[model samples]
Target: MKYGVLEAATAAAIIATSVSLLYTPPEPSWETEVVANDTYGKFVEVDSYGSNVGIAYVDSIDTGLRLAEKSYSTSITDFSAQRKGNWDTQVIDNRSETGMYPSLESKSGQPSISYQDGDLGNEKLYYANRQNGEWNRTEVDNVVGGGTSVGMYSSLNFHQSKPVIFYHSPSQGLKMAEKKQEWSKEILEDGQGWYTETSKCGNTIKVAYTGRNSEQLKIGEYDGGWSSENTSTKIKSDLDIDTDQRCDEQLAYLDTETEQITYKDQDSRTFGDAFFTRLALTSKGNTTHLVYHDEGTGLKYAKKKDGEWTTKTIKQGSETGEYNDIEIDHIGNIHTAYTSQKKVYHTVYNKGTTQKIQSKTDEVKIGLGLISALLLIFTAIRQEVIAKIIQKIGEIQR
Candidate 1:
């Protein structure tokens, strides 16, 4: 009675089909989608298990990552709750410099975030967490460490049910902190806009950064001591990075099993005018998803799905995909959060699991729902229609 791991995207569909029949769209389509133009949504991040999906992104003008969530079984539509801090109104350091480059990770059913805050240019890192319906804030590091520049651009992830962050300090280059009884920090080397990839074994914490002195890209493995090297030519000045994601010259990947960093073959695999990179290694450890931009191509997605490398363009406009983040849901659906045309769009590929068949009865409900939704377009009432649709189909399938 139970299925094994999902080796193929189609295999996951088999599990879905077993649960209930589906109507696969003839071509790729945005079944349920939304884009927000009013808010400044740069550096977007999303995580989900089943129906519970959470999103965090920077409202640059608002000075922090806006948090939202949707906890429904069937609908793949807009967020149900936006800016959901009402559980507690706890505020963190809200200076002029506090809002940039926020990172988010959801674990143990709660989302934890990290960001940089300070006066003018004197920056320090801080963490905010919500649990048991209370939002709390803490300072992970102080500015007194001394730096070549301010310590900013943080990546937050959960390792062994504990909080860990990889952050950049101009004085220290690349640094990492893990939350235990208190926060413990480590200085690995000197670099900027570094990416953190923790091994599945959890014994090793791997990092990749834009090399400063050599101008080359570098990578290292940290486990209570030093292990890293600068092994390639200098990278271009233009680079972008996100959680476990960085794209630049002297490219590389980490072999977590062996705890070694493998440099990519740049001679063959290359890009031009690389902007930003969003990376996601699937929980299965078999596939890797990367979304990035180039001068020639606007926004692109590359994935090594099922041992084959394939790529497609997600956005074709100029200067798109500047700050992007990606996450895979319970099923093998791929969802991306990227800024294009100065607006943040959530591209959903919800073909297999979240998306379901359009039965005759279901289509009628959807048709009627659309009529009601149109009357309430651009208003809060539309969200109510979406909820009914989700409940309608959820009950039908059950």
Candidate 2:
């Protein structure tokens, strides 16, 4: 009777501890830790090479675009005279509007950019490359709008040692250009392409664009003819590429090979407004990293690994993630740049960080672990007693 009571008590104690621990709230896995700042962003973009991270942004006062180039190894050594921090600043155009739609990438470990020459009547697309310590600006294409300004969005990528660009013009809908000493142009679509983005994902060209209405989100490829990879049309989504593909904008990734589009964060609600809600993507191998802000959810990051998507909140303070951009290094580390409270800040993914979670599955796992341990202990103790009792019974029978 005493042994039975003791075993029951042991089991109960284990169960109670397991329950309590399981119920304990998970520690917050993230905090809004800023790495650098003072660079303003109306349109902020972040990208990385190996471990080096760079940012490009444009503010109202920027006659030219701004570049913030820093590495995880070095401190802010040289501060930009324009920006308060130590960023390698470049006077991209100095002409008014040249810096309006700034986008960035790394080439051979140096920064390259594509921006609209937003100088009034010359709303053309320009590519800026740095070679031998000088920025050589090339006019990729001239959008004919006669000064009304149409190249509002421009994205850049490199494929096969050549530059690929995507931009929008009122006359040209969504246009893509490739540079090989000279530029070749093609129009992906006819309507206005709002917030269009293009990138090189392992030789595959992925273009993500919002429509003129700012509601529709569409992804496609820029091959011989532009092929629709995926589309998201919400109740009010502005762009319509497909009648079947449906969802709100939170996170969307394009798998170039399979032409599969994975959309995530549909449960998000706009607490107020996801103003400047932009998404940026960078890929490493089969995994793609996406960063964007949901109206109510603040800044969020996600990566598709082994065909599953897992997301984590970088900031929960509402209305953040605006103009958010993300990059992953060759080593698979993640870096992000975003705007909040009128300031531009940067953050990186820390695997050591504990993520706060309240999950039923977690509780079940804890409970199961305790039960398994208890069962092992009980079986070991009973094995000897059971053998002795069986032997005594045999003796009596004899």
* Per-model root-mean-square deviation over C-alphas: 16.7, 10.2
Each prediction's total of clashing residue pairs, residues at least 3 apart in sequence or on different chains, is: 6, 9
What TM-score would you give candidate 1 relative to the actual structure? 0.65
Q: 1-398 in candidate 2: lDDT tens per residue?
A: 35664467566657755665555444323324453345444677777764467777764455556666665431122111112345455565666566667778778877789887776676777889878867788877774532246556777877787888877877667777788778887777777467676645455666667656444567776554568644544322211111112222234433222222335442322222343356665555555566666556787777666667777777875757666777665544466888876567777653212211334436666777777567657655676677899999999999
- Number of clashes found in candidate 1: 6
Using lDDT, give the best candidate's number.
Answer: 2
Give the per-residue lDDT digits (tens) of candidate 1, residues 340-373.
Answer: 7657666666544333433333564555555544
Backbone clash tally for model 2? 9
Model 1 segments beyond 4 Å from truth? 1-28, 31-35, 39-41, 72-96, 146-149, 191-201, 223-226, 237-268, 271-285, 354-398
TM for every model, in the order presented, reads 0.65, 0.62
Give per-residue lDDT, candidate 1, residue 266.
Answer: 28
After best superposition, candidate 2 residue 339: deviation in angstroms?
A: 1.2
Q: How far is 285's C-alpha from truth in model 2 (Å)?
A: 5.7
